[model samples]
Target: MRRAEYHCAAHHPRDWVEDTGAEVAFSGRSNVGKSSAVNAITGRKGLARTSKTPGRTQQIIFFNLDETRRLVDLPGYGYAKVPVQLQQHWEKTVRRYLEERVSLRALILPVDCRREPTVLDWQLLKWCAASQLPVHVLLTKSDKLGHGKSLQALRQTRESLATMPLVSVQLFSATRNVGVTEARERIVDLLSGQGNGRKPA
Candidate 1:
């Protein structure tokens, strides 16, 4: 498996890296433990920068696993104190990247296991489905709940998205290291061109 290292950061469409090689994007609502999960996956403590305040990271940070594979830390949505127009711009930026980036192979979505998918999360799912893109979801922060609750969350998430042929869900906990190995294996496969375990729906 490729060990990810800090690569580059892009805040606007014009600044994005060259559109070559494969990329897998990580995204979620603010404070979804996304930064933590990303850190755990890459074995880099400060690589993704865990935020004390949600939605403060305003740019897409890229981490390279190799010359041809990257992990994209997309700016968190849904809880920043920024102006409405800025939020809209961020949304547009993320959507445009997702839609137009030819090398983007998969998405790694982190949703708080304690709650249902946020509106932005749903919008992303719908958009990826329409784009025939593959997605893998992490029911993040599962350690906050009991094992039964965690399993239930995973099951419910799977059930809710069962109709989506290229989507898969798994429980994750950055704090306790739960599901870390599984997530890494899956990600390695995705970055290796195996993709999300199926063809588009």
Candidate 2:
């Protein structure tokens, strides 16, 4: 474990932690292994709750790395079973956070390895590009595929988003602890403002 602890949960901007220092956020669709990736990266099992059910994470949850650094878990998107009004609220809230939070360093986007990126995923990537926010894509559940398939998925993702200079893609499998070290290093670089993507305007 990397000494991570729950910091806070925010339902709105007023509920967000003080915008200072640097923090990296995890965003993904429901049931996409976002929580698994967080736990793997931190070396702390169960640090973020994992569930088979969709729409479990309803608020923006924050985990503290230290007083000056943090990890944010944004609400899962693209769950149709969730009420439409609530979904709309989440969309508005997430967009505001992405655009306005100064402490937000980068976004970690987890996509299922078996399929192409969802439309909502592309929307987020484009949004990050417009804001110059660096994004790291984790092809989660990669252990389900053979080595060749995993590599192919990674290459395809990279090729599809080649025009987006700030977006990077890598194969990841929380069950096998794949790419955890690389993910951690990339996060550190982003927090230290060393990533290629520029800060949002």
Candidate 3:
């Protein structure tokens, strides 16, 4: 995780660097803490810009994970306040990147634990499933719930993902430093060519 460093931000296909190495993408609805999780995973305080402002991440940012692998922070979706044209552009950019990137190894999806996955979340999951890509879902904001409630949320998420064999679910709280180590290990293993699609135990 120490080796993770900012690489570049790409707003368009022409601006994107050549996709030639293993990479994983962090994706979620606006304000779901993708930036916070990225910062927590890499132990970089200001790496991804934790912001209360929704839609702060307006482009796909790349970060190098060690020497040969990379991490991607994709723009969030499903927020309504943004202009229609801008939202359409985001949708197109994200879909194109996911469908065409050759070196993408996995997806890290974050969702609020207290609420059921929104329609947009389900849409994203379906896209990943269609692409035959593996995923790890972080039930963010788990610390805001009681232990029993958090466990229930995790269980619900896991059950919902039972049909998506290549996707795994886990309770995570960037605020409480929970599940960071496990998340790092899973990602590092994926980068190491372990494409077996192991489920969380």
TM-scores for candidates 1 onward, in order: 0.93, 0.96, 0.95
- Candidate 1: tens digits of C-alpha lDDT, residues 1-201: 237798878889899988887778898888888789889988787888887788876888888888787889998888858789989988889989987888788889999999999888998898888877888899988989999988988898999999898888888888888888999988878766685532221
How displaced is residue 11 in candidate 3, in Å? Answer: 0.8
lDDT tens digits, residues 53-172, model 2?
Answer: 999999999999987888999999999999999999999999899988899999999999999999999999998998888999999999999999999999999999999999988889
lDDT of each: 0.84, 0.91, 0.87
Off by more than 4 A, model 2: 197-201
lDDT of candidate 3 over 112-148, digit per residue (tens):
9999999989988988888778888999999999999
Name the 10 consecutive residues with the lowest summed lDDT in model 2: 192-201
Error of 1 at 2 (Å): 6.7
Clash number for model 1?
A: 0
> In model 2, how large is the Cα lDDT of residue 186?
91
Candidate 3, superposed: residue stretches over 4 Å from native: 195-201
What is model 1's C-alpha RMSD? 2.3
